[model samples]
Target chain A: MFDVSRVQKELTECNRDKAISGVSIALYEGGSDLSHLRGTITGPVSTPYEGGTFLIDIQLPSGYPFEPPKMQFITKVWHPNISSQNGAICLDILKDQWSPALTLKTALVSLQALLSAPEPDDPQDAVVAKQYLQEYPTFVATARYWTEAFARTSVAIEEKVRRLVEMGFPEDLVKSTLDSVNGDENLALEKLCSS
Target chain B: MAPVPASVARQAELLKQDGNTYFKKERLGAAIDAYTEAITLCPDVAVYWTNRALCYMRRKEWNKVEEDCKKALQLDSHSVKAHYMLGHALLERQDYAGGIKELEKALDLGRGANPASYMVEDIWQVLAKAKYLEWEDLSSKHIYRMHKLMEACERALTSFYTIEDSQVQNDCEEIASERLQQLEFLKDVFGKAEQDDQPKEVPDYLCCQITLDIFRDPVITPSGITYERAVILDHLRKVGKFDPVTREPLEQHQLVPNLAIKEAVQAFLDKHGWAYKMS
Candidate 1:
C-alpha cells in the first residue's frame, strides 16, 4: 500500500514553510485520499516568469515515493522545457532520475528552478525552443506576456476567503470550504450558510 | 530502618521466592499469603510489601494495592515496583494527577537503573495514557462549564422581559452584551486550543531520509547510510541494489540493524505520548 502517513506529513510540512519556499500542496478536489494533490509554486524572482503563480496537478501511483508522483502543469506557460500546448514538463527527475528520497516539495521546487533556467537544447516544446534559440528577445516577450495573462490576476482564493469571513463565518471554516469547491466563491458562500 | 537478623532475612528471601513462583502460576491467594508471611518476617525490606501489592493488583483490589504500595515506598522510597504499582492503583481509582506523578517518579528511577529495561517502557506507556486521560477529562469539564455559562446567559436574557423598569432594562442589556463579549473571548480560546492539536516535528535523524518517516526497523548499509529496513529492501529488489543517496553498491546482506537509532526513537516516543497518534 502507498504510505499515506508519509504523504500527509509532507503536505503538512510543506505548507507550514510555504511562505518562505513559495510552494504549497493541497488535496486535489479537497478529497480525503492522499493520492491526488494540487501544487502551487510562485514564479522565481528575476526571471521572465516573475510575478506569476503556477498550478501543478499531482497524482500519486500506488507505489508512490518508491515510484515518482505524476506531475503536470495546470497553468499555461511559454517555455522550452515545458509544453505550451499541454503543460507536460521535460525534467529528468519526473522520470529516470526519480528517487524515493525526493518529496513533492522538492519536485515543485525543481520546477521553479526549471523556470529560472530553461534548457532549450532538451526541450518539451520544439516551437518554444526554436523561438528561444533563434529569436531570444521575442521569446522573452512572449514568456512574460503568457505569464502575465495566464498566471497573474487569476488567484481569487484569498479574496473569496476574505469575503466569506466578512459574511461572519470563521476564517478557517470559510477558507477550507472555499478549497473544497475549487475556490468557487458562490459555492463556498452557499456551503457556509447551510453549514 | 532496623537491620533484621541474618537468619530471618534468609527465611524471608525463601518465602519471597515461593511467592514469586505462586505469582508466576497466577495463584494470587497463595502468593498473597506467602508475601504477607515474608513481610511479617522482614518488614524493613520493601520487596515483600510490593510483592503482596502485586497480588492485590491481580485480585483487582485497588485500595489494598494502594495501601501496600505506600507501605513499600515508606520502607524504600526509590523502589520502581512500589512507585509503579501505586501509580496503577491510583489510575484505577480515577486519581489521574496522583497516578501521573507516581508514574513519572517510577520512570525517572527506572531509567536511572536501566534505560532499556522492559519496565521502563511499560512505565512510559502507562504514563502517556494517564496524561491523555487527564487532558480529556479536563477539556470535557471545561467544555461543559462553557455550555452551562452560555445556557445561563440565554436564560437570563429570556427573563429580562419580566422586568418593567426602563433603567433596569438598559442595565440588563449592558450586562447581556458584556456576557456575550466574554463568550466570544472563550470561543476564541477554544479555537486556538483546537488548532494546537497539531503535533510537534520529529527529529531529523530519527526519520528515514528515504521514506521521510520515523524509522520502524532501521538498518545501516555498508556505506554507513541508515534507511528503514522495508523501504531499503524494496529499493534493492525493485529499483536497484544500491544506496539511493550514495549510489554505492549495496545488498541486503550488507545491511545491519541500527540498534542505537532504534533505541533513541523508542525513548523519544516514550517521552512524547501525543506523538503516538502520528506514528
Candidate 2:
C-alpha cells in the first residue's frame, strides 16, 4: 500500500550521483507492525564526517501527498541542526521550506549540503554548532568522536530501554517517560527527573 | 444474553498500561504495540492515538506518527498533546514551517492543550535549537501571540501615522526604531554575529521580499542570497537573456549567487545587424 517505489527511484539516483558519499537506505518493518523507514547518508568527503555514515529515519504519513513526511537522524552525529542525543535535525525544509515539488532526493542532498556548510548561527545542536564555528578543531574532534561512538552502528533506543526495564524500573513509568523523550536515553532521564 | 468478554477490556487496560510504561521507559517499540492494541479495542479513545503518536515519534517512525497525531486531532483538535505531537512529527520530517504553525497553535491555547507542557523546559530549549532565529525564536514568546499583538499595535499605530502623515505606512521601523538602535548598541557588547545568540536584524532586501504580494508562500529562502526572486527576474530581463518583449528566456536561464551580478549577460544584441532568425 505504501509507495516505496519513489524511495527506490531516489536511492538509484543518489547512488549514481556519487558526490554524496556513504549514504544508504533501509526499511525497518514490523516490530509492533511499525513499518519503520530508515536511511543513512554518509558525511561528505574530506569533512570531519568524511568516513562516517549518518543514519536518518523517515516516517511517511497516511496522507503522504497532502501532508509532509517526517524525518530525523537515527545515528547521532555532531551537527549544527541535529540534536546530539536523538539526532533530531532542525532544518527548515522539513519544517517550512517544504513544497510538493521537493523529493526525498532533494532533502537528502540538502542534508549533505548542511553538513558541508554547517549553519552554526541557527543550530539545533547549539553546543556542538557553537564549538564547530568558534573552535573548529575541537568541533572536528568531537564530531569524529561521536561518529566513532554513535554512527557506524545501529543501536535501537527501545532495545536499551527494554534492557533497563528488565533491570528494575516500573514498566509503566519507564515506557511513558521514555516515549516522552522519543527514546533518547539522555532525554529520557531528563524527562524522568521532572516527570 | 451473551456473556461479557471480560478479557477484552482487561487486555485493553493492560495494553494501555504497557503503552504508558513503555512511553516512560523510552521503549517506543513496545509502547507502540501497547497503544495499537488499546486503539484496536477502543478506537474512539483520543489518548490512545495521542500516546501512539508519541511512540512513533520516539522511533522516528514518521508516517505512523503523523497518522496517529491526525487521528487524535480529529478526535479533538483542541487536544494540546495532539498539536504538540503533530508539531514534533512535522518538525522531524523537515516541515518546519508547518511544524512552527502547529507549535504556535499548541502555545496559543496555553499549557492546558499541549502535552509538551510536561517537558516545558525542553520545548523552550528546542525552540532556540534551529539555526535561524527568526524561524522560531522561543526566546521572545509564541510567535502567533506576538504576531497577533503586533497586528493590534500596528493597527493602532497606523491610525496615528495617518494623522501624522509620515511617508512610511505602518512603519515597523518607525515604531521600533529606538528599540532597534538600543539593541544594535547591545550587539556590540554581546558580539552580534560572532556568538550567534542575539537576534540579528532581518535585512531590508529580505524584508522587501516579505512585503511583496507574490512572495506570500510560507517558505524560508532556499539560498540565503541577498537578491530576491523578483529582483533576479528583473535583472534577467534587463540582460536580454530573457526577452522582456516575449517574457521568455532565449535559453534556460540559470542564476547562482555571488558571481558578477551578470553572468552570460546579453545586452543590446542588435537584431537588425545579423541576429535575425534564419527562415
C-alpha lDDT of all candidate models, in order: 0.82, 0.58
Go through the candidates in order and give the C-alpha RMSD of each one to the true structure.
Answer: 13.7, 30.7
TM-scores for the candidates:
0.54, 0.32
The numbered model that scores best in lDDT is 1
Q: What is the TM-score of candidate 1? A: 0.54
**lDDT of candidate 1 at residue A185, scale 0 to 100:** 76
Q: What lDDT score is found at residue B116 in candidate 2? A: 33
Model 1 lDDT per residue over A21-72, tens place: 9999999867887898999999999999999999999999998777889999
Model 1 residue pairs with clashes: none
lDDT of candidate 2 over B1-279, digit per residue (tens): 344367876788788998899789888788888889898887767888988887777777888878898998888887767777787777877777787677656643432222234433234333323223333344244534545655565566557656755665565666567655654554453343223423333223322221221111111222333232333343344333432223344332343332222111111111111111111
**What's model 2's lDDT at A192?**
62
**lDDT comparing candidate 2 with the true structure:** 0.58
